[model samples]
Target: MSCLVSSTCSLVPFDSSLNRPSRSSKLGSSISWQSSFPRLSIEIGPVISSPIVKKESFVQAAWTRRSRGEAAKRPNKKSWKQRTDMYMRPFLLNVFFSRKFIHAKVMHRPTSKVISVATTNARDIRTNIPSLVDDEACRLIGKLIAERSKEADVYAVSYEPRKGERIEGKLGIVIDTIKEHGIIFVP
Candidate 1:
């Protein structure tokens, strides 16, 4: 019979009859030496060894996947924010576009607070811009947000497009306008 110490331990065989204790032969002792525990023998197995390597960060993994033509494997909005929060700057500039209006906000991620905001529905923008929603309106909103962000001391911003929105066309114009107004866009 054998006893297990750990999962990877090897089995060891022993002759049970030779190690059994006698009941009659006893010295004048208060406590008995014989006990119920079974005697066991162990044979150590060979040591196992394996190589270890450091794992890549989420952002690096994402870039690698992109380079491999696996665009669909990119992280979603929630995970992207969580990963970026670890290493990138704490300030984030978020832009949202809708059917009738475009909205932009500069947010401090660490404190979860908005630094500045601008939208087509604002009083000054509505009064100055003729159309509420269009390429021109998008540019105006971008410029307004950049100016306001500067007032709040935020010079750099990250653009987070929605699920399938491409960074071109009207969206491209908005981003260019923000950059022209002296705000940096984090890639």
Candidate 2:
């Protein structure tokens, strides 16, 4: 028997007598302990003479049948968001939070050009801000970035939050500030 506790147990052939209690010593006073379980027999087959053959997996078969054009398509992770969204959404809003600063920027996706950038590290912002990493700093950066993007004629943009990361707290404050500053966020 293959078990977690131990593998020392060996299968024994079934015993018909162990199926029921002995009728001759059934009285309560005359009792002898006996196992009631029927032992099961295990059969082991001879080892295969031929070497084991490797079967083609479903994924392998599908890959083999795939067209050359399909094979040439993007295979990296988040290809849809990175490639498709680049063209679909012309303007991209990206925000980065650092230990001591908040950086927000807008990019023109088609041209791969950085359109507007606002950061707490800038001389003007750095000199005025009391705390560079707080919500107020994020809001200031967000508002400045949004206004700059508008000056570049980009009113609608898209922000893709990191996968599995919540858009709340400081990040949320930045985004909300941008919207309040008249920047439209595309779904």
User: Which candidate comes out best when scored by lDDT?
Assistant: 2
Worst 10 residues of 1 by lDDT: 50-59
The sequence of per-residue lDDT tens digits that candidate 2 reaches over residues 25-134 is 34455433423233332223244343322332122344335466765784453544676877888998889888988888899888989999999999998999799998
Those runs of model 2 whose alpha carbons end farther than 4 Å from true positions after fitting are: 1-83
Model 2 weakest 10-residue run by lDDT: 1-10
Alpha carbon deviation, residue 59, candidate 2 (Å): 26
- Every candidate's lDDT: 0.69, 0.74
Please give the TM-score that candidate 2 achieves against the real structure. Answer: 0.58
- Backbone clashes in candidate 1 total 0
Q: Over the full model, what C-alpha lDDT does candidate 2 score relative to the true structure?
A: 0.74
lDDT of each residue in 1-187, candidate 1, tens digit only: 4434452332233334554322333544444433222233233445445322223212233322334244455545345667666358777777777888888888888788999888898887788878888989988888888888899888988877778989898778888999999998887
Q: Estimate each model's TM-score.
A: 0.53, 0.58
User: Mind sharing the TM-score for model 1?
Assistant: 0.53
